[model samples]
Target: LFICIDHVGLAVPDLDEAVKFHTEVLGWRELHREVNEEQGVAEAMMGTGDQLAENARIQLIAPLNEDSTIAKFLAKNGQGIQQMAYRVADLDHVSAVLRERGMRLLYPEARRGTSGSRINFVHPKDARGVLLELVELPKEAEEH
Candidate 1:
């Protein structure tokens, strides 16, 4: 049901500031930037621009509204590890298993996520106080 670690989500107060810091200090290149309106947040993926894909991903996220969860987290805890997303082969199977085990889900159903993959987030309570995001890509979506 689960594949591998997709990416680590880091909440940031300001996306541009974080982006500039990472680009200038760490020398990472910006791979993509996107605003997930449904999720009420914006994000940027930074990487080394080399052959290694997984080694250089740093996702910076900022909230779109003051009332948003990200905004609340930033206000209370400051910018830090927001969640960890894992790539999965079968979202339904994973969700069903998690439900059977009494795990709480942040999203009742899978929704659109970055890179065109379907995603669902598990509650922090069930994920050892860390939000867990599960991502699954359709076969057709993976081909391209």
Candidate 2:
């Protein structure tokens, strides 16, 4: 159903500060960064050693506005671990299987995610109170 743990997402009040702390203090290297307006968040993918390795990711996500989900999560739980992402070979297939198994996904269809990956979320309520993100990397990236 899943390849590996893709990344662990951390909700932060400030993206720059989070990235700086992770990079400078934690000795992580910044791998990728992007802003997804539709998701209303700014994110950075941090890593060490081989950037593309499955074990090398820690995503830092910051709300773009007060209305963003990250903002709401921060308001309720404070800045912390927001989600655990799993890599999938086929998002649509995995989504269908999870649906058949009675897991509720947040999106009816896969949505655009960091680094051109197709992604969807398993509802926190259905995922044992943990937000779970499913990601299918782009074809070119799959070979890496």
Candidate 3:
């Protein structure tokens, strides 16, 4: 159903501070940064070293406004790990199989994700309280 852990999402109150800490203290390098208006988030994708293609990354997400889910999460639980993403070769097929197994997906259709990957989420309740995201990297983005 999945290839590997794509990236772990962290909800932060401040994106710059988190990125700074991750880069300076934790030694993670910032690979990408963007504001997803549709999702009401400003995120930074951090990688460990040279292998950006295969390495597991950490996504630091901060709320763009109070209406953002990240803001709500922070208000309720403070800053921390928010979601776990699993990489898939075929998101549509995997989503279908998961649905057949009685998993409740959060979206009816896949949405755009970091680096133009297709993504969808499994309901937190269905995944035992951890928000599970499934990501299918674009074909040309895959490491050969």
Candidate 4:
């Protein structure tokens, strides 16, 4: 089951510039930053209010390699929103149900995500043209 929107992912041509704009222009504070070699992305999470709160942030994703998915997205669509991530209470169960209902998952198996969560994406075509990411945070990270 879905809990709430975790963050909206924006594919950016340059991570530093994006982060600067969000922080200086929009007044959002950078909460976290990481480079995932496997995913071929360098991302920074920006939040306006409480950094620890769920659904209060945006993730700026920049390609770490030219051949990465973000790079392809930028080439096709330019820098913009790439995906909407939703936090789920039970990722495995949700994934199973989606499969049973004939939905296409980008990563069929759950993979490590930012903040140590298990995550997978529902293909854009299967999700009505919106790339949707499903994230299941660790028990301790859940909002009370």
Best by lDDT: 2
The positional error of residue 44 in candidate 4, measured at the CA in angstroms, is 0.3
Global Cα RMSD, each model = 2.1, 1.0, 1.1, 1.4
Write model 2 residue lDDT over 49-141, tens digit each, in one string: 664864479999999999999999999999999999999999999999999999999999999999999999999999999999999999998
What clash count does candidate 3 reach? 0
Give the worst 10-residue stretch by lDDT in candidate 3.
47-56
Better of 2 and 4 by TM-score: 2
User: How much is 125 displaced in model 2, in angstroms?
Assistant: 0.7
All candidates: TM-score: 0.88, 0.97, 0.96, 0.94
Per TM-score, the best of the predicted structures is 2
Residue 19 displacement (Å), model 3: 0.5
Whole-model lDDT for model 4 versus the true structure? 0.90
Model 1: CA > 4 A from native: 50-55, 138-141
Q: What clash pairs does model 1 have?
A: none
Q: Clash number for every model?
A: 0, 0, 0, 0
Deviation of model 3 at 91, angstroms = 0.5
- Tens-digit lDDT string for candidate 3 (15-132): 9999999999999999899998878999999987657565669999999999999999999999999999999999999999999999999889999888888999999999999999
Candidate 1 colliding pairs, count: 0
Candidate 4 residue lDDT tens string, 91-134: 99999999889889888589999978899989899999999999
Off by over 4 Å in 4: none
In what order do the candidates fall by TM-score, top score first?
2, 3, 4, 1
